[model samples]
Target chain A: MAVAIAEARIGKWGERYYSGRVLQLLERGLIAFRSSTWMIVFSGFFEPVLYLLSFGYGIGKLLPTIDVGGETVKYAVFIAPALLATSAMNGAIYDSTMNVFFKLNHDRIYHGMLATSMGPLDVALGEISWALIRGLSYACAFMAVVAPLGLIPSMWGYLAIPAAVLIAFGFASIGMALTSYMKSFQQLEIINMFLLPMFLFSGSFYPLSVFPEWLQFTVNLFPLTHAINLVRGLCLGHINVALAGHAMYFVIMIICGLFFTTRRLNALFMK
Target chain B: MPESLIHARGLTKKFGDFVAVNGIDFDVHKGESFGLLGPNGAGKSTAMRMIGATSSRDAGVLTILGKDPDKHGPQIRAHLGVVPQQDNLDMQLSVSENLYIYGRYFGLPRAFVKGKIEELLTFAQLEEKRDAKVEALSGGMKRRLTIARALVSEPEILMLDEPTTGLDPQARHILWDRLFRLKEQGVTLLITTHFMDEAEQLCDRLIVMDKGSIMAEGSPASLIKDYSSKEVLEVRFGSDRNQELAEKLRTLCERIEELPDRILMYTEDGEALLGQIYASGMHPKTSLVRRSSLEDVFLRLTGRTLIE
Candidate 1:
């Protein structure tokens, strides 16, 4: 029974390399993510829940409620979906970027993995799979918190969980791709410099219409903008053909980012 | 049919115009230990990487397990085991987990891998430490675990790059004993190391490599006999007085080497050289006679110390 999988022979070396590596990574990734499960579930769900309770409800008492897409919504409803998107982006990028680099250069776990039948593609895919898994967990927890609060206005908001996963996959791929070029810990400061301003300015906390036209266009370039828009659109019970185009943006990013990341991993490890 | 597990003619590798491994030719027959012995920067590791099907050769015919590395790396590597220079053990996993995961990578079933992991942990002498994380283990333990992980798939050919480097005497002896046991089992082994003692102890036959090329190839005893004399007389005239001392002992020894710290007299009989030195009444400090070993043979052929 143990050798049954070995019966279906791998067609070629390069072809099976990624699949084998992913299998190894998936096993290890389970260990890594589950080890930190308590911290992940607590931080992801409560941070947003607290915001909905304190600022959205508590601070919302200070001002008049605004209308979003012809529907008068509470401040809690306004921020709930955006926070889910934020959690997805945060979980994916954190698990894939810094964690991936540390495992690659310092721990040399992948070096040991590479010595086996596993290849570079397996590493990239396994890492991305873990990132997606973490994204889903966070998204589910965030949505569960919001749904209990009666913040979600429509049934379509449930679909946002998988949508957030696709979005997180996009960000995680780019993050892993970027980590490949970093040679030192000092270089990681640049990742923060790039990620922090995107988090603040990508309309995570506010609507994009508040920004100037040129600034809004620039914010649209950030992946978080589309993710934020898609989730926000779903939670507010707003949908249209435009949301399809917005979701496609994340899909394109996923393909391009994965391609670049796999290529970069091959260049660094195979050499 | 007993065939050559490894066959190569002029295998070479270069990294961006820097020739890491110049064109080289060699072969490893079934179930034999082959070695590449050289100092640092001698391309020994690069050559092993090619045979392990991890690194691509620039311009030579190379086949490992009857398949080209470029085309059949995964298939060929499936039947091979590699122990790299540094112990690249998984820090997050326990000693047994390391072996279990490697077995899984070879597409082994979970049940089969569980049994193999237990067997390998015992073979590596890591059974007691099986549940401990690799980071908690000592250097020798980690290295042994790495070797154990390599054997998880029961590979046909095992490649060890500097198997006992940086190991203390006790650890090195333990590793050597394990390697000898593996050899006795008729597992084909290919190894690379700069330690002459290690080579003499573990290798049945070796090829001395230098500057990305093969300098000489033979058994340890044969190489020593061919390049070096039966005995060496160590004479210390003080580092400052080497030239004058050489002039004085010129006719006494067959050949002399003026080292930075001491002078060496290469002669067939050390007693004759000692008698001549005593007759001259030059009682220098520290004189001893010793049998020739692989270090002397390496120095004679490469014209440099192996350890630099």
Candidate 2:
């Protein structure tokens, strides 16, 4: 009886573009992970931790404290949220772009999946959700480490976990959309080139005020800047209207990313 | 006539200016093994893709199981088992895991798929390699596993595109035997193959295609009878002499084809034609009389070999 109702619902909603079996892809990813190199999966979680230790502690010793918004906090506290946001972005980007590129071009995994009852939307949502899991885990791991160090000063700081997922979602959706247009591995290198500069200059390590107005405007255009600001605002208890803007930025990114990823997958495999 | 499972009329697909599948029409009936026989770039794979619901047609009407594929692609694909020309198995997963995940993609219950796995493994003869990674398997094993994976959904129509293109003769026979069993079990098969022997061994009915158009359509035997003679005499007077000897050989038989290396004489009695050639004082280096095949039919229809 339950199966009948579910089928009826799926029949009505699918419209030949989705089958509501996105989670099955997650199941496949998890099963595949059992035999995959565990070190690579674990490595994303450590990137932020290493950055915190080397930059937060090493630089924190020299600076002692920094003024964020109106509150004066230890140098480690200010940069911790930025690293959290960066890690979420990094994990999501790596999973969605490089890993997805390999699967799309080399493994032809999506081709096999689309041949089943599953549609392009199912594949897009499933893969993006998997990348989000990696992003969410990195955020949670980063929070667990920093919360013990007293880097998180407010109760609202825990919201950064979901916020980190949003950040991951934004980067993942856009990353996948862009990766779909990539014909060669060298084209993928262009993404990395843009990502490195965005990471280094998106006020991840210092204040955006240090850059010229034109430069700051250019940096603000980078999605990482909004991610860092949003995560930093939550961790530092500097909640304001601007944070909503940052969150809205990701909401828009997610929509655009999903739209294009589905269309591209359909065009590439189903056309 | 017996419940058409697939129907197409004037179906066409174009890539820019190149017409991959021109306006062509055919029907596949229930419990029949249908084939699209053509060489590479003959649009057989393109037509299969349209039937598989993975590609949308540029023009004309196409319906699978009485539903328009363009409007019901996912629903149509749910009933299809497509073995693509290339093996797209998940390299990251073990053999069984590839089967497991594929069933799950169709929303099959875990228990049902788990049960189906053993039956398919036995059928594909891959029970011993259940835990083996796809990359670790040999070519034949990989092909069998791909076919097994396609069956995980218990699909209504099994579509194989060049199912045995790259396997050795032994492996090809084994694969053909498995496909033959599926036919015996009443699975509707849609296959595309360039090898004449494979087509003759597997297809119940077929359409010969060249340059995106159907050149001929019939059962293997009927096509051979309609377009070719009962027997063929292959006489090779050396490569240099083959063209010169073809003029004389033509008058001795109903039809003669001058290939680069040999001259083929088509007749009702190949032995009689060879005797006549010998009586005419034409000494050939070697002569053989054999039954005509789909290869000869293709040659007659398009003036070209099927493999070329």
Candidate 3:
């Protein structure tokens, strides 16, 4: 079974080199990730739940119900989408950036891989795919628990599985790109400097309108803000055409981030 | 002669203002152990990198498996295995896990790699440490694992860059034994090292490089025969008097090299040379006779020692 996945036949080498190679790379990663500690897989499922327990019921008891999707909803229902989005974001960011930096500079793991048939594109795509898997698992676990508590109101909330994947890919792509250029462990602080602000002000905690008009324009620029908007709209059953724009933000992130990431990875490895 | 697996004419590489590998020409034949023997700053590694299809040459024609590195790096590299100078084994991974990942990099099946890992662990003498994480092993163990990792793909040409640079004498002998086994299996080996004894032991034919250029190229015995004599007679007059004493002994042999502490007389007949020195009434603190080696050839060619 392991052999079959790793030995999937490939067609060509140049340009489309990543097509046949990504799965093997992903399989390699899953083996390493699984064999190591394994505490991560189970522990990762708890971050969102803790947030739900601590903030949802703790702060929810004090605040009155808020209107979402043209109907009054409990405070826990309003905050669940944000917790889910951030959890996915955190999972992907950790996998794509920190682990990547360790592999590239400290461990020199990818250097050994590059000596073989595998190219830089394979490394980038495979890492992002693994990150997406990690993000998706946490997203699913969070949803599974919250659904039992009657937090999910809309049948459309199931679409957040795919939505969480999109957010993970978008952030993981850019995170890997940023890490490709990092020279030292100190440079990793820059990723947090970029992520923490977006997490705090991306309308995950409050509505975008609550911020001033000028500040709302700035909040719209961050991808997580759009992610929160999409998941919130879906979970709250607020269906509209504007949701396409929010979804497009992540798509654009995927395209541009993957583009720059492949270029940077190729340059780093090739040079 | 066997067909050349790697061919180069005036190959060169530069990093900004510093030229790492100068325009040099050579051909690496199939199924023979070839070497680049040089000092620390020599271009052995840069040339090896181009041949491994990873680093592109700045100028001149270079081909690995008859394909240009610039255009077909991955394609050419697919058939080659490289053990870089430094050990870069994944620290967080088990020994077997390292082999598994490297095999998958070549797109090899997991079942095939799993089978190969057992044989490789035995070859590396690391079967006891197979399940241990890499960081927990000793340096020699890690170096062995690195070489074993490179072998997972069963490559056509195995390139080892200074394979035993930091290893102790015992570790180095074990590595050389493993490499000899690979050679017996008819795998083409390309090795680079600054150790004269290592070059003498492993290399069938080698190029002596200095300051990014080839100083001489031949079999180890041929290089010594060509550049040095059958035996060297060493005589130490005290360090303060060696300079004055060297002039008196200059005409006594085919050649003479005076160092800070002693004078070396190169001659086919060391006993004759030593008798002549004693007949002239020059007293030495200590002296010995030894066969000439690649280090003498390097000294003859570059006027500097191979290793400080």
Candidate 4:
């Protein structure tokens, strides 16, 4: 009955591509999540925590403090927010890319959903929203670990959770969009190839100034660079107009990713 | 006459340069069981997809429940329950959850879907397997669960593509009985099948399709009557001699088909034809007499067997 009302409301436009039942897909994902192996889900949450313990704390003893935007901070504090951003990206990308690829190619889940009144846009939105849940939970989990350790020094650090979500939203959107075009499991390896270098060189560990000017410019183009910068600024209380610019990059990514994901899904299943 | 639940005129689809459905026309009325009977790659599944509102027609007119599919795909799809050729049940979910999620996909209320799940489980005869994962079920059970999932929306039209294609004989009979129950309940059924026996058992009306075009359209009995004799006489002297006897056998019946393994003599009376063949001093290794069927109709129309 709710569907009928929603359909009547949006009946004029986008009815061919959307049915306003995206939450139903979320419901399905949640149910499936209950039965799925919890080890993999926990592995995504634990990945950054391990990185923090090893790199942030272990390496922090050797190099005590770093200067960011003229504000001096411990090395552990500087990298904690970046780890949070990385955790969010990893969680969202894993769910959106690998899990979604399996469902799309092997399980044929979207074929079943689209055969109903639900459309391609509903699937794209529903799936991306589910991935965001994983991203959000990981952000919260990372914050829970770092907050007690004095890694977040500023009251403004609370905003990092939302920032992590935004970062997750960007990666999840683009991940699904890219995964839609993948035809085989081997092609999915290309994602990890790009992600590894982005994680290492996106100024997550050290300052981007350490690289050559051309290399720094290339690193800045990575979405992770903006994500790390945005979250780090909030954690260190380095408030500036530049923060909104980073957020806007993700907003544009969200829009473009959604547009292409919906189009690709429609072409693949509804053609 | 009842209004058509589905209408198609010159309906066509193309994948690259290959035409899948080419300028076919048909109408399915409310509460009728309509079949698209054809061999593989005969365009039956393509036409089914267009009417189900999942695939767009490249050039033609298609309307389901009085709305254009290209413009109102979701609205039209809301009235349809589609069972695809493959069993696409979510392996992560159990049987009941599969049905419940499908209902939710149609935007049905949660409480309503929960209630509907029990009824559908009972309808599909999977009540004992409700909590079992889809992967654990047998092929027939999986197919039944898929059908149950399709009915979760209580759709006016149920579109099944090759519903019993891979099932054993007993499983096919069970599926046929379930479909018959749906027909009795007045649900409009649209089925696509390469199995002539399945079409004969289920469809009230059907279109014979071949090479992306409709060869003929009618009820099973009418098609057999129009295109075949009343009965068929099957006689096999041996593989080597079957072809040799084609010319002599051709003179004994209204029509004859010389298959590699056997000779088919079409006549109004198979028993009388056999006696005549025997009187002509022709002794066959084996002989059988049977009533004409959709197989004979298909052979007569296309010069090929339905199963190929």
Best by TM-score: 2
Where in model 2 is the C-alpha error above 4 Å?
A: A1-11
- Per-residue lDDT, model 2, residue B147, is 96
- The lDDT of each candidate is 0.81, 0.90, 0.85, 0.90
Q: Could you give candidate 2's per-residue lDDT for residues A1-271 as a string of tens digits?
A: 1123124434576557888887899998798777894567799888889999999989999999987797899999989999999999988898899989988999888889889877899988998998888888888888999999999998889999999999999999999999999999999999999999999999888899999999999999999999999999988888899999999999999999999999999999888
Model 4 lDDT per residue over A149-232, tens place: 999999999999989888888999999999999999999999999999999999988999889999999988999999999999
| TM-score of each model, paired residue for residue | 0.95, 0.98, 0.94, 0.97
Per candidate, the number of residue pairs that clash is 3, 0, 0, 0
Error of 1 at A221 (Å): 0.9
Interface RMSD of each: 3.2, 3.3, 4.9, 2.0
Worst 10 residues of 3 chain B by lDDT: B70-79
Native-to-model Cα distance after best TM-score fit, residue B189 in candidate 4, in Å = 0.6
lDDT of 3 by residue, A164-255 (tens): 99989989998888888888899899889988899889976567778888999998888888889888888877889878898998898888
Please write out the lDDT profile of model 1 over residues A103-193, one tens digit for every residue. 8788877776766666677778888988898889888878877798788989999999998898889888888888877898778778878
Docking quality of model 4: it rates as medium
Q: What tens-digit string does per-residue lDDT give for candidate 3 at B22-127?
A: 9999998899999999999899998988887667689999987787778666667777889998777877779999888888777777789889999999989999
Which 10 residues in a row give candidate 2 chain B its minimum summed lDDT? B245-254
Model 3 ranges off by over 4 Å: A1-19, A68-71, B237-239, B260-262
Screening candidate 4 with a backbone cut-off below 3 angstroms (N, C-alpha, C), the clashing residue pairs are: none
**Per-residue alpha-carbon lDDT of model 4 for B1-308, expressed as tens digits?**
89898989999999999999999999999999999998899999889889878889999888887888888888888888889999888999999999889888888888999999989999999999999999999999999899988888888999999999999999999999999999999999999999988999999999999999999999999999999999899999999988888888888876899888898988898899999999998999999999898888889989999886
Flag regions of model 4 displaced more than 4 Å: A1-7, A10-13
